[model samples]
Target: MFRFAMLTLVAAVSAVGAAQAVVALDPVRGATALAAVWREGAPPPQVQDRAAILKSADGHYWAEGEIQGRPVRFLVDTGATTVALTQEDARRLGYDTEALVYGQKVLTAAGEARAAVVKLPAVSIAGASVSDVDAMIVEKGLETSLLGMSYLGRLSGFEATRTSLVLQP
Candidate 1:
């Protein structure tokens, strides 16, 4: 009777293992069924590091980012070396434009201008964030804030298509 009970237990374990194998091999079972069998009815979690930005009519990529929990618009400029903020935008974000020393001279589309270098505590775009980003406050000749390489370089990758830009973090 003891040998018979052991044999029955082994057979029962083998049956359960074979059922799982069949569930894994069967295409009709699908992922939902497989999840039910393997994960106690919980679906697999998805984790992706991608954000897409649609191109504007003016043939530029624009992104809306947050600095200190406040929204700021930026023209994505791959040619720019660091994130450049307009003096107005800087002021809106609580920076005192008059007090900041404009010691950095940089070239803009309009002409050469002086800028103040500042480190942002954090900048977030489309759920991706970078902390302690180096940025500049252009004193003049900047119509729009720029999202430049300082932030983009920290990302894993980015690509531009005809209609959109995809950012990989």
Candidate 2:
């Protein structure tokens, strides 16, 4: 089942050179596909500039990234308009959470939440990188930090398969 899903995803991604279509799967199929991908996931060998493959994790695509010279974990989330972070995660990434000015109202599963806008110097995933990213610090209702369009929209393209997500810088 997992292998089949991976192959399906790979074929879809390769066809368009972007995974935007893969993410459209219904929740159950999406989750299954993600699990299969992560089970066999590994970073691409012989790293190339602005190109890399990321495997899914648990039911989501995750990546080890850097912000402000500190390592950070990111949950790839295209649904999110901008990079959204928990205050705790922001602090860990060296952002002065206490100094942040929360002024934006955003909707979350938990209800309305406030967010603080901030600029990230740079964020790198595997060998590809993007700079001057716009992000938001949500004080609550968010369980994980997300790498959203603020970063993804900057990419030349990205593709997804049941087994992996390919990023083009």
Candidate 3:
């Protein structure tokens, strides 16, 4: 019984642990097709992890502990209208670029930039979850991941008090 329970628990966690980020394939296909694809072959698995990014330590950020285990660096940028990712990060996430739907123009600190809008299956940050997140595929050089209003705004809100900005989300 103990062994069965442990095995069940492991199976459950493994099945849903990654569900925080769900990918939706357009024009849904039947399970048969999906099974066929799986039986044949598919791309490599993407590394997923979760870690903390802190400021008290210095102007430091770590890419390890992202919500779904994807590498990410958090940045506080009000100038940005949305949480954004560099192209490198997108590549790290297995975005299936061939299926990407191109989108609009954006103005960046550097200058006007062309960005392809892609909906992240899901983006989990600081225990806060948001799905169908609108993110820009950064085309230029960026210092860190832009934690803009799109994701932050969905959270309760942020307020600065003395030493640190209190992020309620």
Question: If ranked by lDDT, best first, what sequence of candidates would result?
Answer: 1, 2, 3
Q: What is the C-alpha lDDT of each candidate?
A: 0.62, 0.60, 0.43
Model 1: how far is 165 from its true place, Å? 0.9
> What are the per-residue Cα lDDT tens digits for candidate 2 across 1-169?
4345434544433443222211112334432111101112454532465455555444446666778777766766554457777777798887787788877665554545667888888887776789999888876766667677788768777666555566777
Model 3 TM-score is 0.54
In Å, residue 73's CA in model 2 sits off its true spot by 0.9
From the highest TM-score down, the ranking of the candidates is: 1, 2, 3
Over 40-101, each residue of candidate 1 has an lDDT whose tens digit, in order, gives: 11111222767766665544456777898888877665545578888888999999999999
Could you tell which candidate, 2 or 3, scores higher by TM-score? 2
Q: In order, how many clashes per candidate?
A: 0, 7, 4
Compare candidates 1 and 3 on lDDT and give the better one: 1
lDDT of 3 by residue, 107-161 (tens): 4444444456776766765445566676666555343455555664565554432
Span of ten consecutive residues with least summed lDDT in model 1: 32-41
lDDT for model 3, please.
Answer: 0.43
